[model samples]
Target: MQQAGIPTGSTRPFGYKDDKRTLEPAEAAALRKTVERILTGASPRAIAADCNKQGLTTTRGNGWSKETVKQVLRNPRICGYRSRKVREFNPETGTESVRVEPVLDDDGEPVKGQWSSIISVTDWEAVTEIIGRNPEPGDAYNARKYLGSGILRCDKNGCGSHLRAQKAPASRKKPEGFFYYTCPDKRSGYGCGGVRISGPETDEALKMLVISKHEEEAEDRQATGVPEEWEGENELARIREDIDDWTERREQRLVSKERFFAFLAKSEATERRLVNERNEWRRPVLRAKGEPIDLRGEWGDLDFVEKRAYVEKTLLTVLVASAIRLGGPVRDRLTPIYRGED
Candidate 1:
């Protein structure tokens, strides 16, 4: 079974039939449409919602999700490559671990699968490049309880460390306990010297701040109006030119391999940054046209992960000042730095 290029599982890829030898026409078509939509600037979240509306399900018969759609887009199997998960057992510990490894042909390239390709290699690569530019979501394994753990930054002088949420020490006044966001450096005795802020108060402050910003943006759109077009082409073109120049230099042996790779990394980072900035420009236009979300009403109902995603999308950094006095005044200490504005 290991010698064969088949996945050692019952589940087949979404665009393929259970037999794994035939293409499911409808699923294949859906995959193609998904890639096309992504290239045309539709987000994974939008695509997933559309899939659900159309009664589409994953290969495992589950509802479509952003992560699911992203996985499908990133899978090399769509290009006819064979992917397999190999499980190895350790004799000493009697433990097993599984790792995904691509099967290779005689020439050491990825093995072509028995099934027909749903998407061409070029199109698959293009889709991957576009998706790679988007910011990835935080890990869901250890989902945060407080919304501000990673997004909030300690604003103590000479120490701008990320704030972490931890359960506040139990006291006679409130034995049930509470959470607080404190500088990890201070907690670890690294000497950040930052003050801890009440988690519930910070959350409320952030919600209000987000709502206020949203309202302000709405008014601004009504007055000045959203931009008619994205002006990011020039910057993106410059970055691509730099990438090509670096590639040519590497090919011509003008730059060492290490330097070439470093230049490529920097260029790619800049490209992703510029692409995100371009997306931010489009978001306002979408909001004006009533296509994007307005989180005011649904804010309280969201879970920690959902709230974190919203905060990350809207704000770049939340600065936490020293909480000199607790309770209502703590809300005034928080300063939200919105994206594109900073």
Candidate 2:
């Protein structure tokens, strides 16, 4: 007999109806028990092994396989939720079944509409979160393009720079229709006595060690791995630790209670400092690193919070020096990192 309208090499006629369907209540109950067993630490492979050993057959009466076991686990029918979407192939069109799954919840969980749910809402959430990480189509994976746009600093002293975007001719034949970034201040801005060079020229001039810092950060994250959530937890733990230590010292009479209260009064100040530091570490280091540039689409596409993140990542320091010389030495004085001028 054929299952899911696929030819099973069996002598089953098309459109032949069978009273014994696999999605019945009894099958659902059995499937639920099987799912519960698996969730309680039984591996899918092991469960498949046990099912095959017991001479149990899938809907097609075929021997159990690990893949089938996984499909069953993911199926929602066992949990009394019917799957809304079922595959129905058009024999004439030779088209595959289309997905009709609905957004299960606001968190993007899949809801049961036709087949019963074998997994709980929580387990479903975990699986969805894992799967969601797989990058989708149209997803460009480069950090440097946008982050380094305005932030890359020119190491040249007097020319301590801000990025300048200008269109200049690349060659005689082609009008180089590309964004060329350079140190605006270094090239010919205030106090910058250094020679103003094009972005492509300066890229060649910059030291490899300085340029590679951003690339190293990106590569290291890919290699060792970093979780997005851990950063917040780490900061929270540090804050709590500091608070606890202070409290303990005061309670144990090691530090006077008055001193402890005084410190408490400054808690908001400490919090502001910590918040600034958090923003700093997460900030992108913008410098030419011979890395692939990744401008993340248009600015209008980005939301406000993301725009702020982009600003924090780029736009390093604004150096203040004496006067710009026509062709003299640039000072190396480092000024305050611009946090946006008032």
Which predicted model would earn the best lDDT? 1
lDDT of each: 0.72, 0.44
Span of ten consecutive residues with least summed lDDT in model 2 = 12-21
How does model 2 fare in lDDT? 0.44
> Which stretches of candidate 1 lie above 4 Å from their native place?
1-13, 18-22, 29-75, 83-85, 88-94, 99-103, 122-140, 143-145, 150-177, 182-196, 204-317, 322-332, 336-342
Q: What is the C-alpha RMSD of each candidate to the true structure, in Å?
A: 9.1, 19.3
lDDT of 1 by residue, 212-299 (tens): 7767776676676656667887889899888878877887999999999888888899988887676555444545654324457546
Maximum-TM-score candidate = 1
Off by over 4 Å in 2: 1-26, 80-342
Ten contiguous residues with the weakest lDDT in model 1: 133-142
The digit string of per-residue lDDT tens for model 2 on 1-342 reads: 111222222421111223322345544555555544443323444556667777877767788765566555543333333333456666897866533233354323344433324445443323323223122333234554432344445556545555554566666343455444545543354434332334443333222222343345556544553334425546656775777788778778999878888886676467556655543333222111122222222333333334434355432443333325543333232233534444
Clashes of 2: 27
